[model samples]
Target: MNRTGAALLLVAGAGVIAVTLALWGQPLVSASGGIRLWVNSIWSPETSQQVADWYSVSHLVQGMLLALLLRALPLRRPDTVLLWSAFAIGVGWELAEHTDFVLDRFRATTLYQGYLGDTVLNAVMDYVFMLAGVALARALPVGASLALVAVLELASSLIARDSLTLSTLQVVAPQQAVADWQDAIRPARP
Candidate 1:
């Protein structure tokens, strides 16, 4: 993508993030310090719903992967292709997260025992985060983009509570050890 296209994506991303914050109107979760650009805790019971938490990283990684995957396809205007894909995937996931079945699935799992659905503001922010990732992938070198994807995946899991890869693994396979580990971090309440 050209500089102009990348700049536009950045502007659009910022606008969406701003709109999300405006819509939130109030902080959903109050951390000890306050809303931050990034929080290290994965499931603090305090900062989970804050502006930037562990699961927030998942959205960005998802966008990077989706953008990369879509770009791989033989399509002209790859950025446009990515834009539509992000819309469909982002909206679909937002709707899915609110569904009873998906919420139950999350509740049954290790990572999200207190698995209430996301707030509308958080949901919107999540979509915008993905857009940021898409823009990053388009603007950065392939190696740098891949490196970022790697760093995000690792940091989220190691420094926080969950990650895209771990979430997908637990969802698809439901491993005992992973479940045990997650339980160790924040045990499920009765």
Candidate 2:
């Protein structure tokens, strides 16, 4: 399929996913009942309710990594397949993320003590951000993409005291020391 066709398909897929989420009783917006472009505090109740948050950075990185992975593989038309694959993965994660199993895991292990799943808007925007990442990876040099990933990772870590890497480690391993450090370093919630 052509690029525009593939993009439209992904948008349709996102629409279906959004409707499914609504049916599953997920809110289209935060409990605050507002539509925000960005929410600065990751610790706030509005964290995953808005269009963008710190975790959105991780999603963007996810796209870059997925695109790079597909490019490395001996697959035909990787560019054509990249968007669909990334959208499927993102939707899958968003669906699973709202499940009791994943939510419990995050609450038990990560700094997301009060963690709830993303709002529909946030979830959909995440896919968009990932697509942006895919475009970015295709546009920039390999070294540049990697450098951007490094910068984003470091910036998220320093700013939030938790990042995609740390969150993944916490879920997969759950080191007590790291959890304690995260709790200690977490800024006072508003």
Candidate 3:
């Protein structure tokens, strides 16, 4: 699709996400009625309320992976398809992530015990971040893109004790050993 068409598609997707979140009783911003550019702690109540957090890295990786997957398909217009597919995937994930089933699953199996759904702003920004990842994947060589993914996964895991890879593994197949290791780094609750 043309640049204008792609931009319109993304804007429409964001609108849908925001409306859905509001319908689901998600606030437009934090309870404090403020918007933050970033929240560093994955354990913080504000993590998913803010515009960006460590899991934002995971969304970026999702975009890259989606782009790669679409490109691998035999579509005649891979670039155009990538944009549509990424939008669909990002919107679908945001909608699904807020559901009780997914939220409860994450709470039970992952480090996100305090997990609530993202605020509208954060969810929209996540879609934007995912688009950024698509851009990154298109700009770099395949090997470089893979290298960057490795670096992002390793760094996020090392810094936060969680990453996309770890989160996926925990959700798909919970392990007491890994949970213990992740919980070891968590600050004690008051």
Candidate 4:
């Protein structure tokens, strides 16, 4: 199979897995009930399922990073490979989020306070969001891609009270200061 073909298969497979997770009882959207394309409505000041939410940008950043990693490989088209790789990673992440260990950690930690997990629709959309990032990284020069990631990360922090780095820090270290600041700023869940 060619790289593009394989990449497409991987994406399809990941979609199937996400659907399975949803059917297995994962929420599809708002705990109350909501599903949207393009963007999620603002549930709170700090949180939204917007198509381009901070979390969605995180997926894009992940795609950019993945593109950088795949660039090391001597593939015919590294972008294609990166897309599939990002999809695989995204699927794995979604599955992991549904696991007891990850969920328990969120419950224990301040970073993901009140976090249950992504809904089926959101999980699927996240993969799409990441793919969009991968596309951007592939289309732009490396420097530009890096710049984009930086901009997105900065915007996410300013608007969402969280970014990839902030979330990572909270998860890995769990600092009270970070948690307090985020808590104070994040919108209260309805």
Query: Candidate 3: which stretches are off by over 4 Å?
Result: none
What TM-score would each prediction reach against the true structure?
A: 0.77, 0.91, 0.95, 0.81
Find the candidate with the highest TM-score and give its number: 3
Superposed by TM-score, candidate 1 places the C-alpha of residue 108 at a distance from the truth, in angstroms, of 0.9
Q: What's the C-alpha lDDT at position 117 in model 1?
A: 63
Instruction: Give the alpha carbon lDDT tens digit for every residue of 19-109 in model 4.
Output: 7877778755666554444442223422333334557778878877788768767999665666567767877787787788888776676
User: In candidate 2, how many Å is residue 149 off?
Assistant: 0.8
Alpha-carbon lDDT, every model:
0.70, 0.81, 0.87, 0.69
**Candidate 2, residue 143: how far the Cα is off, in Å:** 1.0
Worst 10 residues of 4 by lDDT: 40-49
Which is the better candidate, 1 or 3, if ranked by TM-score? 3
Off by over 4 Å in 4: 1-7, 36-52, 73-80, 187-190
lDDT of 3: 0.87
For model 4, name the residue pairs that clash.
39-51, 40-49, 40-50
Cα RMSD (Å) between model 1 and the true structure?
A: 4.4
Candidate 2 residue-wise lDDT, 3-112, digit = tens: 78877867876797688788888888888888988777666678888999888998888888888878778978776677678777877887888889998998887577
Check candidate 3 and list the clashing pairs: none
Q: Model 2 reaches what TM-score against the true structure?
A: 0.91
Query: Which 10-residue span in candidate 2 carries the lowest summed lDDT?
Result: 181-190
Clashes of 3: 0
Full ranking by lDDT: 3, 2, 1, 4
The residue pairs found clashing in candidate 2 are: none
Best by lDDT: 3
